[model samples]
Target: MSQITTTCPWVTNDPLYQQYHNKVWGRPVYDDRELFAKLCLDGQQAGLSWLTILKRQANYEELFFDFNPQEIALMTQDDVERLLLDTRIIRNRAKINSIIGNAKAYLAYSQNGANSFSQLLWSFVGGQPVINHFNVMAEVPAQTPESQAMSKALKKLGFNFVGPTICYAFMQAVGMVNDHLTSCPCYLESSAKK
Candidate 1:
C-alpha cells in the first residue's frame, strides 16, 4: 500500500505540477531577480493556466537572459519578433512585450536608492508572508486590497499586465501571501516561515 499524500486541491497528479506544488508554491522568495522572474511568469499566465507557463519557464529564462532586468530592458522589437516564432513559449506578442516592458520598468523602479525591487514588493505585505487559514480552495480570494494596491503601484511605475488578479496570483506565487489550505501539509510549513 502506498502512503497517500494530501496537497492543495489545485495540484494535479502531473509530476511537474506536483513538484511545483510540493516544493515551490507558497514558499517565500526574497531574491530580487527571482521575484522579478516569478512576477513576469505570473503575468505570462494571464490568459492561460499556470501549468502552461510553468512548462515553459526554463525556455523563458534561457531566452530572456535569466530574467536579468537590465538585459531584458534592452530587448527590442526584433527580439520580440524572434521570440514569437519560438514554440517553447506562449508566443503572444503582447505578453512577450509586457515582459520586456516590465524589465525596463523594474530597472527604473530598482534604480531608486531607498528600496530594492524586493523591498518594494515585500513592503506591500508588511515584509512578511500573510498566512491564511482557509480550509478549502473556494475560500481563496481572487483579489484583495493589498493586491489591488500592488497593481496600482506597479502600473503607476509603468509595468504592464499587473492587474489586481495578476498581482494576487503573483503574491501567492512568491509567498507574499500563503494560500495553502489549512489541511494541506504545505500550509503549516509555509506559514511557519517568517
Candidate 2:
C-alpha cells in the first residue's frame, strides 16, 4: 500500500506546482522589489491562471528588468509595443500597460515616505499574517474585507488591475494571509510562524 499525502484541494500533482506550494506559497516576503514583482504578476493573472504567469516568470524578470520599479516605471509606449510582440508573456495591451503603470505607482507610493511598501501592505493585515483554518476550497473566500481595503487603497494610489479578488490572491501569495487548507502540510508550517 502507498502512503497518502494530503494537500490543498487546488494543488495538482505537478512537481513544479508542488514545489511552489510547499516552499513559496503562503511564505512571508518582505523585500520591496519582490513584493512589487508579485503584485504585478498577480495583476497579470487577472484574466488567467497563476500557472500561466508562473511558467513565464523568468521571461517577465528578463523583460521587466528584474521587476525593478525604477526601471519599469520608466517604460515607454515603445517598450510596450516591443513587448507585445513577444510570445512568451501574455500579449494583452491593457495587462502590459498595467505592469508599467503599477511600477510607477509603486515608485510614487514608496517615495512618499509614509512607510515602506511592505509596511503599508502588511498594515492591512494588522502587521501579521491572517491564518485561516479552512478544510475545503469552498471555505476560502474570493475576497475579504482586508482585500477590499487593499484594492481600494491601491486603486487610489493609481494602480490598475488590483481589484479585491486579485488583492486577495496577492495577499495569500505574499503571506499577508494564509489560505492554505488544514490538510495541507504547509498550512501548519505557515500557521506555526504566526
Candidate 3:
C-alpha cells in the first residue's frame, strides 16, 4: 500500500477524517443539494467542532431529508420540534431554523433566473479552488476577503448565520477554497484537479 501524508492533525491518523480530507475537502461542489448540505452543516458547526458534526452526518441526512432544499424549505414547525428531541444531530432551534430559512433563500435564488447558489459562490474564485500553501494548520486563515464578500452577499439575499467566519468555513467545506496544508499529499492532488 502507498503511504499518504496529511497536515491536519485531526486527520493525520483517523480514517474517517482522512477519507473526508482526501476525497471531499477542497473539491469544488456544484450540485445544489450538496451545496445546501454544506451550508447547513457549516452553520450548525458555529460553536461545535467539525468532527462532531461529521460523526452525525448520517443522522443529519436521514432526518434532514437528504438536504434537498425544496423539501427543507417546506419543513414545518412540527418538523423542528421533532428534530429538537432527536439526539442524532445538533438540537439547537436557531440552527435548525437557519437551515430552513437558508433553504427558502436557496430555492428562491434558483428560481429567479440566477445561477444556482453554488455557481454564484464558485464564481467568486472563478470556478476554481484558491489553493493556499500553508506549512501548518494554524497558518490556515479563518476568514478572507472572498469570505467577507460572500457573507455580505448572502446577507443581502436574506440569509442568516452567514458571518465572515462561517462563510469561510462554508467555502472550505464546499471546496470554494482549497485550505489543505502543504505537507498533506492531498493538497497538491486537490489543487491539480483545478
lDDT of each: 0.91, 0.90, 0.83
Highest-scoring model, TM-score: 1
lDDT of 1 at 107: 84
lDDT string for model 2 (1-194, tens) is: 11235378776776666677777889988888899999999999987888888889999999999999899989999999999999999999999999999999998998887899998899899999989989899999999999999999999999999999999999999988998898888888888886
Candidate 3, 1-194: lDDT as tens digits: 12566566656456776777777877878877788788888888898888788889999888888998888999999999999999999999999999999889888888899787768888777878888878887788899999999889988887888899999998987778878777778777878886
Better of 1 and 2 by TM-score: 1
Task: For residues 83-125, write the lDDT of model 1, one tens digit per residue.
Answer: 9999999999999999999999998888876598888899999
Best-matching candidate per lDDT: 1
The 10-residue segment of model 1 with minimum total lDDT is 1-10
Error of 3 at 115 (Å): 2.0
Ranked by lDDT from best down, the candidates are 1, 2, 3
**Model 3 global lDDT (CA atoms, 0 to 1):** 0.83
TM-score of candidate 2 versus the correct structure, residues matched by position: 0.96
Cα displacement (Å) at residue 58, model 2:
0.7
